[model samples]
Target: MQSKDLLQLAEQFGSPLYVYDAEKIKSQYNRLTKAFSKVEKLRINYAMKALSNVAILELLRDMGSGLDTVSIQEVLLGLHAGYSPEKIFYTPNGVSLEEIEEVNAMGVQINIDNLSILEQFGAKHPNVPVCIRINPHVMAGGNTNISVGHIDSKFGISIHQLPHLVRIVENTKMNIVGIHMHTGSDILDIEVFLYAAEILFDAARNFKNLEFLDFGSGFKVPYKKDDIETDIEELGKKLSKRFNAFCTEYGKELTLIFEPGKFLVSEAGQFLVKVNVIKQTTSTVFAGIDSGFNHLIRPMLYGSQHHIENISNPKGKERFYSVVGYICETDTFANNRRIPEIKEGDILSFRNAGAYCYSMASNYNSRYKPAEVLWLEGQGHLIRAHETFEDLIKNQISLPLPAKV
Candidate 1:
């Protein structure tokens, strides 16, 4: 989005807000679909945990993207966004059997990760079709916290345990309709992805009743100016060719599924915060914004880098300033980063803030979370309202007598 548009949003809805460009989301979705258009059937099941605003969900739905959920609440959110039950897939890890049953009752696709849940769910619902999540154990991701499919990770069923999985399905007469595997997020090596896909394909050979193959998404997006990202075009070309060969060998037309989160909306979002103070210390200068980890915690929690721009003074002289938050802790966004000089009251926009930003925010320090706005076709629509003081007390009960305080 342009600086003027962001400034207008800051003025209209106030600062410390999340603004998403809907056009960018649409374009990203199109890029994937167009690349894999040659496949018989391709589905983009967006990981809703990344950014689960109802408006964004609806936008993705309108763009013909399926829903990938990790919890029952996300399944409900997708349903609320007008997605059909068949279009949703619940892929939970280390969850209870009761939760799996609840999701199964919703009539959406159920992907069982662990072997225990798989055995129990299949025994109870033998006739029901299910999907299996496999851990390729490739260990390919940018960060350890984001990586989930290594040998020690507790994400998917181990490839060596295929015998147990086969036994359970055979004994229960459960229909294994699909196969899945996810290495991790922010995957930079395309060869590693190809290797992971080979493992998924090998596992698919065990299930003759399969109709679809889900390669759980971890496609990377550029975080910095020269940082590397997944080459989707090249990946689509290579993986698609191999996938078609597998389909021919299996003698059935199968659907290809991906649960991409970051690749879809990371670049479409901007988190705007107003500079509250400019502290000049003997050692360093600080550009303190009126926000904290309570609003965007990716940098503090995951060491994620977000490109910050002083939108209010885009052309100002450059300087090194540590951008810090107003929270009562060592909450730093970037330390001694060189950017355009920031002044008091200047508005700064944090790029690549779409995925895992607002969805992971908290109301810590008794601070209210900011509002969310969507920029669709050159217009800004208020998707969420900023929290008020009453929100903190919404769930608290008032006591008649406070024990003689």
Candidate 2:
């Protein structure tokens, strides 16, 4: 979107709003599908946890994308968004067996990660088709907090425990229809992912009833200017060839699945926060904004870098300013960053806010979450309204205090 367009959105939707470009999302989905067009049976499941707006879910559903959900609530949201049970895959971590059984009863595809749950669930419902999440013990991602396939990560069943996993499967007489592995977010190396796929393939050989192999997505998107991203085209070409050969060896064609979140929508999102104050300290110039980590916490939590642009004054002279937030904490978004001159009330657009931005927002400091807008066909549509004081107290029970008790 153009600077003027973003400025208009802020003016209309109010400051500290999330603006998503629908065309950019569609273009990304199309790019992925076209890259892997050679795959006979391919499934792209949109990871709902990254950005779980019902409207966004509907958009992905209309694109023929399946849902990759991690919780029962997300599964229900997907259903509400018009996704069939068959198209929704529920893969939860460290959750209760009851929750698993509940989702299973809902007819969503169940993917078990730990051995205990696998044994318990398989013993109870051996007739139900299930998927197994395996940890390839490969470290792949931008940070330790995001990586899950490492040896010590508590995400999936370790590859070293294959013999035990096979024993449990055999004892329960359960049907394993899929195998999955997720190395976490911001993965830039296709070779590492392919190597992990080899591990998944080896595991798949253990189950004759396998119908799909989910190579969970962490394909990195560019966060800054000239930043390197995952080579999806090359990876697609190489993996498609290898996958077809594997299908031939297995004597059956299985669906190749990917659950991507950031890659699909990161570039499409822009978080617009209006500048509240420009304070000059002894050593630094702080450009405080109306929002805080409560609105966009990737920087404080994951050390993420979201390119900030002065959309209000794009052509102004460049200067260095540290972007902070209104929260009563060290909620720094950027430090000593060079950008167009920013003044009080100037709107700054933070790029790459599409994924994990709104989904991770919190009501810290009792602040109202900003509104969200979807831009489709050159027009802005209000997908979510800004929170009001009533919303903050909507669920609270306001009982009168006992006299001086």
Candidate 3:
């Protein structure tokens, strides 16, 4: 998308809005699919938690992508987006056994991460197929906050307890269908990820009924210019060769599955916020935007860096400014970042805003959430409307104001 296009979106949808480039999303989906094209049975499940707009989900679904959902609501969102139960993979961590069973009843894939839940669910419904999530104790991701395969991470069942896991499977006679492992997001080292894949392969050897090996995706996309990211082409070439060999050894060509969220939509999304003020302090220049951490919290929550551009003035002189938001708390986006000179009312485009941006938005400070637009085929369609005052109070039960007492 061009800078002028983004500026036009801001003009049409107003500032503090999310605009997703459909073509970028399509290209990303195709890039990932092509990476593993050698695999006989490959499945790409878009992790809907990244950006769960129904339009985006449908776009992926049209391209034959399944969904990787965490919550029951996400699963429902997939269904609402017209995905079949068979196309949805549910891998909930620290959720209730009842919820697992509920999703199981819906005929979606069930992936349990803990021994207790696995045992309980298996003992109750051994006939249903299940997937086991294993923590390989690998830290390939860039940040601990987003990484889940570390030793102390609370995501998957530790690999050290494989014996106990096998025992539970044996005791309950559960049909194991897949093995899954997610080391976390923004994978820093491809070697570490491949090492984790070996762990998953070894775990898969224990189950003869397995139909697939889901190497949970943490593949990184470039966040900024010249930033390091997961080399998908190289990783795919290496892992695909090893995966085919493993399938041969297993005596069955098992499906290769990945659940990628950020890789599919992160670069495709652009968050547009207008500069509300340019404060010149004694020693620092602050460019305050109309939005805050409530809309994009990755910087505050994960210390993520989203390359910001002054789309309104692409050729302006370079200047150092501290980008901030209007939230009451210290909502610092970037500190002393060098970008093009920004003026009041200048539209700032935050790159890599597709994933984990709107999905993580909140209504803190009772502020209205921004609208969402899908830029498809050179047109910007409003996918979601900006929240109204009624939306804020729609769920709250109002009384007679305590009779003025």
Candidate 4:
């Protein structure tokens, strides 16, 4: 999809909208599958936490990809999107044992991330097959906020505690079928990932009934032009060799799985926000957009950079402008950024907006969330409609003025 396509989507759906290129998603999926085509069995579980719209989910489902869910609701979404229970895996973190039991009852694959819940679930359901999420203590990913497999990150079971995990499994005779690790999102270092995979392989040694080893994906995607990206070809060549060697050592060729969120969809999204006003302050020129942090918070929340292009005037003279939002508080998407000259009502498209942008949006400042569109097979389809005032009060309860107290 080009800038013109995004501009057309904005014009049809209005600004402060999310437009996803379905073709990009298919190409990415094909890329990963083709890269690792030599493996005996490779599974790509599309992480639903990144982009959970039903249309996107359905699009992925049609691609023959599995679902990697982090919550019960996401599992339901996957199911609602036409994925079978066997194709969905739940890997929630910091959740209660009761929740785990509830999800397990749904017959989906269970991935336990903590020791307490692992032991609890093992004790309760010894016959059930489960996956353990091991923390490799590998420092990787783009930012601290996203990195999960570090020594200090509270995401997976630390590798040092493997003995306890083994004992718990042995004591309960629980079926340990998989070993998993997620070093975090926005991972650029390929060696660090291989190092983490080694840890996962070591952990799989104790599980005699293992079926797969999930090396959770955080393959970095380029945000701006000339930016570095994860070398998937190199990674596939190295990791596949090691994985095949491990399978040989383990006496069986188990499935290789990955739960990739951003890597699959980050490049497929474009966020379009309308320019509300062009203010000329004393020190800088501010291009205030009609949206705010509520719509896209990565810039302020994680210092993530989104390539902003003034599609309205792509060839116009360039100028440095501070792009601000209309939210009541201070929300700056970009400060002192060089872009083509912007005018009032010009639509600005934020590239690489597919992953966590809309999933993390909010209704803060009493504003509505933007609509979402999916462009599939050269056709535009409205995935979600723009929020309405009635939607804001859909769940609200009206009290009779507290009985005139």
Q: Which is the leading candidate under lDDT?
A: 2
Candidate 2 residue pairs in backbone clash:
none
Give lDDT tens digits, candidate 1, residues 1-405. Answer: 799999999999998899999988989899998888789889999999999999999999988889999999999999999999999999998889999899889899999998888888888899898999998888988889889989999999999999999999899999999999889999988899999999999999999989899999899999889999999998999999999999999999899999999899999999999999999999999999999999999999889999999999999999999999999999999999988989899999999999999999998999999999999889899999999989988999987986765
Off by over 4 Å in 4: 402-405
Q: Scored by Cα lDDT, where does model 4 land?
A: 0.92
* lDDT (10s digit) by residue, model 4, range 92-122: 9999998889988989999998999988889
Per-residue lDDT, model 1, residue 292, is: 95
Candidate 3: tens digits of C-alpha lDDT, residues 102-187: 89889999999999999998888999999999999997677878889999999999999999999999999999999999999988
lDDT digits (tens) for residues 1-405 of candidate 2: 898999999999898999999999999999999989999999999998989999999999999999999999999999999999999999999999999999999999999999999999999999999999999999999999999999999999999999999999999999899999999889988999999999999999999999999999999999998999999999999999999999999999999999999999999999999999999989999999999999999999999999999998898999999999999999999999998999999999999999999999989999999999999999999999999999999999988978975
lDDT of each: 0.93, 0.95, 0.94, 0.92
Clashing pairs in 3: none
Better of 1 and 4 by lDDT: 1
TM-score of each: 0.98, 0.99, 0.98, 0.98
- lDDT over C-alpha atoms for residue 268 of model 2: 95
Per-residue lDDT, model 1, residue 209, is 89
Candidate 2 global lDDT: 0.95
Cand. 4 TM to true fold: 0.98
Residue ranges of candidate 3 with Cα displaced over 4 Å: 401-405
- State in Å the error of residue 83, model 3: 0.1
